[model samples]
Target: MTKIQPSAPLRSPHGSLLRRKAKDNPTLASILGSYEKFSTAALSLVVSDKNSVFALVEAFNAYRNEAVYLFESGKNVPQENLRSTMLEELFSWLFKDLFAILQFDQPTNYWAGKATSSYLTLTFAPKNFQSLFEDPNPKISKKDQDFAIGATVAIKVMASKSDDSAPALTVILPVVAIECKTYLAKNHLDMCSATAQSLKRANPYCMYLIATEFLKMDSEVTPEVTDISEIFILCKAENAERKKRQSEGKPPHPMHADVVWELFSMVMGHLRAVWWDPASSLDRGKVIGRPF
Candidate 1:
């Protein structure tokens, strides 16, 4: 199949916010405009090499500083997932360009995974056979990843092993999943761990990752014991009360280019890796190690 060309996002998470905006809204207008600028800049230059990565990084950080960090508190932030939705759109714009260089044709949704619920799924019914003409009711558990490459497959099943069929069994499998959070607290970390296990159970080769703007844990906590591949702290801020601290005149922990580059490298390595060949690492005398 032919691959779709990379382009600016046709739609964004701000549709509802835009619809709900007061006639004289200014902050939301500025934020939405900044998002468009970043999207345009991202597509204007394709990340063909490391030099291009630098240009993209400059644009990416600029967006975070101007658009993402401007508002404070949910009451004034427009939407709780506003920042996260921006990340999803920006990452998809950038990653699509990068993936174009890799040039693999596959049926994976890049930016839209945020709408697809999750990286795993299940199907169940009493073989009701109520769906020969009607649609099946599949229970979809929402994963709602920030950035993910996955697909949902629905297979309609036969009722009693006969030609008559029942509700379809749908599997929402994510091959590579990235959860985006504005800030990750301890509780969020626990949820991430459980989600990682759920993804792994469905596809052992799945790459589960977390990308958070800040660490909100009471103390520094590592996720080594968890099945998550890695957590990218985009801005390694002193956590616990970053918002209150920032409101008190602390400097914004702007996302570092280095951190973004590290994330890009990790993703590329995972994409190029051979996960299954048992002897693939024997010649190197080492196992497939996760890159930090």
Candidate 2:
């Protein structure tokens, strides 16, 4: 009998086009400016403030352990509740304290937490992109509109508006959107991918992410889900549980520290790009334009 050889992996026809497009993506370029500098600043904060890092890790572990306990105890606790609670606490740690370490002047009026609104409406229309549109009069299509579905966490920057006839009032746009999952299953991944794609269509620059406590899905990045900038797995399942499973051994998961650091750096980078003013050099001592 002749030995059979494994077939080569299939490739998408538009792979080159996609790569080229991503390379030319101005939004991506601007957001990821000076990666080394941003990462160094982010790392220094973690290394300098051991207490904050410890607190964040403790909070994350506690959240996961609580969920596990609730599930194992046969309680009817909804996974959504656990996920929401965890993300809320995590974001508080990130935006309130950790991110401030990177900035020269503390940011004021920045909000990061669960979104109260049903749907995030875009103020401006996409001119160059065809995937998303600005619906001047957005109507509710389904029980949950496509735009609002699966939007668990939001980060907003406050803006002031003034008119000749009215006093100035504060308003905000959903600058960053996140989808959280207790365990990222196939269905959850699909849902998040769809949501991210829709958000990108509407606003190409919107920072979109899918975060999960446990990574229960394949490690491969779905080519179709190009809009999702990152997929973060916060923690791994209990080692004992994994070991008990005879067939599947240890699953692929990132370390807690790495995940936290990466997430923090990404968040800080976005904040710097969007909220920080270069001219004033508010929190940043000096203005350094993007080198590349």
Candidate with the greatest lDDT versus the true structure = 1
lDDT tens string, model 2, 1-292? Answer: 2322212111221222223443665532332233223222323333224455555455445434423333233355332243244444444334444333554543354444554452334354333454233222223211122111122333332222322333322333345666666567777777777766665565555677766666566557572436677877776564334335423542333238667667666755664563425776766675643211
Taking all chains together, the TM-score of candidate 1 against the true structure is: 0.76
Colliding residue pairs in candidate 1: 117-143, 117-144, 119-174
Location of the lowest summed lDDT over 10 successive residues in candidate 2: 5-14
Off by over 4 Å in 2: 1-51, 62-67, 75-80, 102-109, 118-172, 219-225, 237-255, 274-292
Q: Residues 5-117, candidate 1, lDDT per residue (tens digit)?
A: 56323334443344355245666676666656766776677655667677777887777676555555466455555655755655565466545666766444333335455
> Candidate 2 overall Cα lDDT vs. reference?
0.45
Residue 19 shift from truth in candidate 2, angstroms? 49
TM-score per prediction, in order, is 0.76, 0.51
* Each model's Cα RMSD: 5.4, 19.2
Candidate number of the best TM-score: 1
